[model samples]
Target: MSPGIPDRRGLWVAVGAFVIWGLMPLYWHLLREVPSLQIVLHRAIWCAVLVASWLTLRHGRGWLREVLARPRLAAMLAASGVLIAANWGLYVWAVNAGHVVEASLGYFINPLLNVLIGVLFLRERLSAAQWISVALAACGVLWLTTRYGDFPWIALCLAGSFGLYGVIRKFAAIEAVRGLGVENMFVLGPALAWLAWIELGGDGGFFSLRWGGWTDLLLVMGGALTAIPLIFFAYAVRRVPLSVVGVLQYIGPTLQLLLGVLFFGEYFGPDRAIGFGFIWIGLAVFATDGVLAARRRVVAQQA
Candidate 1:
């Protein structure tokens, strides 16, 4: 592969991952009858199983050994695991509780949050346009809060947790699949315990036959659904530029926003639109700055 040339296959893979993430609200909506906590537990447990199995098969325990050798990395993965689990649980609850629109808002805010995180924690400097973009996003959030007479905590929490998770992973310095596998392993104990308690207590949704085979299948497939896109993302990032990935990430939230409005039929009145419009403009500024920065880097490299 030439420098500055994207791998077409990787590009498609990245698109697939974002598309899956975007369409995930519909998947969770199917399990609306299941408790959000239970759904999250199932996701954690199954995702761990799938990721571990794949890692073991691919590297035959070498990856595990590599991760175990670095205690600091292991600890970082644990924190990231907790953050990701919280994100998953909250997102599921929000979707089933008819807050899909708000959930989408969280993801929409995530990239900007990532930028803020870079500035705050990583000591990375932001350009003037980047600062403007972040300010606009803040104003949008403020508009939504004051106009709607409620705080947008859901969006904030999601963005905060996921943004921190990304930062932690950035410092972890491990392969993405292996890092995720370790992260999930750290949470697997609690996840399994919760699942076991519910099943033993007869509160389990799986195999209850209440929602029938379809629900059971969906619950199990949750693991694959959780891990596969991440795998695709891992593959894509190695081959594609981070700027392209950043732009593509909006696909997921955009799809979620559409689903929340057109399919799930959540409220999207003029007020909401005005606030979102602000944030959208901010994202436009942010993304444009990123693309232009990437182009400058490429030009410098060519020179």
Candidate 2:
């Protein structure tokens, strides 16, 4: 199913996930007083628990035993595990540092990054419009860096890590839920060991939560949110065309922009405006090209 073929339900669900992710700064801000490392720990631990429970319930203990039996698959998942964990860590850090808007910018650039990855890794070709879009977006980013006297590290890190993760997962070949479950399982040992160390140390561990009761609750929500998106995304990826999914990704960054300006009080500089303007024009060209291309295909098929 392509965007050319209407799908209100899937569109809504995909949009919903992006909305939640965009508004994450609001939720993660509550944990600002907490250490970023502790936040990562909670995200990893709770997300692992949530996915594990789902797997156990759906496939029983046998599936887990099967994962254990496949040593090579386990190793591949372990590598993916680290990549996603790093992505999450970078995101959390960005959210905590009042860089949510920049983080959103990263995602806005991600589709173009995907296009680049396709060209580079998958030997996929981009149209002239697509190449121009990439160049414009890159120039926008560079303009911001020159104007601000520093690079948008958060934006670049978020996009680069995420884009690379998607590429890696493309090669991983595991089912969505199972893949996530395996990735979590691969990291569980190290996470548990870290928690254990935090507990035994004089610094405190399990009970040393900053928000106390609410922290655990939020952590659980984080895990469920983390796991559920993959389910819909996985479902959508299979059922829908890549073009549809690509278009849907913009919702997340749009939400974050609002959050940054409205909630976080980030100033909208003229340079950013110019940069974003370039990006908008570029994407407009790219999307128009896609729409026309899709239409031509449909018309040809009909003829």
Candidate 3:
């Protein structure tokens, strides 16, 4: 495909990925009975299995060889693996513990955190509007903190881990699928160990007649749940503009927010609404600036 040409198929694929992510809370909600730690352990194992299988079939070990040969890349991926695993574990616990709204808030703040990382670590400059957006988001967080009488650590942790993960991957110079495959491999060992311990304790969920077969199957499907959207994301990014992807990324959090309020019947009082309103205003500025900037760049190129 030409670099600048838009493809409908790619757009659909990307949207599909974000939609799956948006609706993912419901899936985890179904497994609320399962321990969050165990759920994450299974997620790590099955994600590794699925990703590694796809990588092997697609390239017959070429990508793996390349990754292994690069010690720095492998080290970076190892760190990323740990971060992503923590992120997954935390998110699972948060969802199961009925912190879905806070979880969604984390993702909402993630893009802004990413911008902050870019400024701090990459020495990138931000526009005035961008600065305003960041300030608004900070105020929003403060609102939430004040209302809750404590720091929104769950939101902060999720944003921090994922934002840092994005930073590491930004410089890793690896393909998305392969990078994820390698990262998952690093976590797979611990995941297997955890599962073994659970099994030894006679609490393993796999093949348990007590837990319906459907539950067991859904647990297995966790691998696909983890991998498929990433695969779609990988496919989409190659074809779509970065700006488009950035906008589409919000779909996940939006869906999570709605699901929290409507489906899960989580709290969303006026104070919380005001806090979210501030954050939403910040996001509006951020997204508008991004879209306008992208358009200007495009127009300048054509000129």
Candidate that would win on lDDT: 1
Per-residue lDDT tens digits for candidate 3, residues 225-278, read: 999999999999988888788888999999999999999999999988888898
TM-score of each prediction:
0.98, 0.91, 0.97
Q: Which of candidates 1 and 3 reaches a greater TM-score?
A: 1
- For each candidate, how many residue pairs have backbone atoms clashing (under 3 Å)? 0, 0, 0
Model 1: C-alpha RMSD to truth? 1.0
Ranking by lDDT: 1, 3, 2
Ranking by TM-score: 1, 3, 2
Candidate 1 on 1-303: residue-level lDDT in tens? 766567999999999999999999999999999999999999998999999998899899778778878899889999999999999999999999998999999999999999999999899999999999999999999999999877999999999999999999998998899999999999999999889998899888677777788998899899999999999999999999888998999999999999999999999998899899999999999999999999999889889
Worst 10 residues of 1 by lDDT: 202-211
Q: What C-alpha lDDT does candidate 2 achieve relative to the native structure? A: 0.78
Candidate 2 residues 126-172, lDDT tens each? 89999999998888888888886669888888888888878877887
Candidate 3 structure lDDT: 0.91
lDDT of model 1 at residue 178?
Answer: 91
In model 3, residue pairs whose N, Cα or C atoms come closer than 3 Å (at least 3 residues apart or on different chains), thus clashing, are none
Off by over 4 Å in 1: none
Task: Between candidates 2 and 3, name the one with more favorable TM-score.
Answer: 3
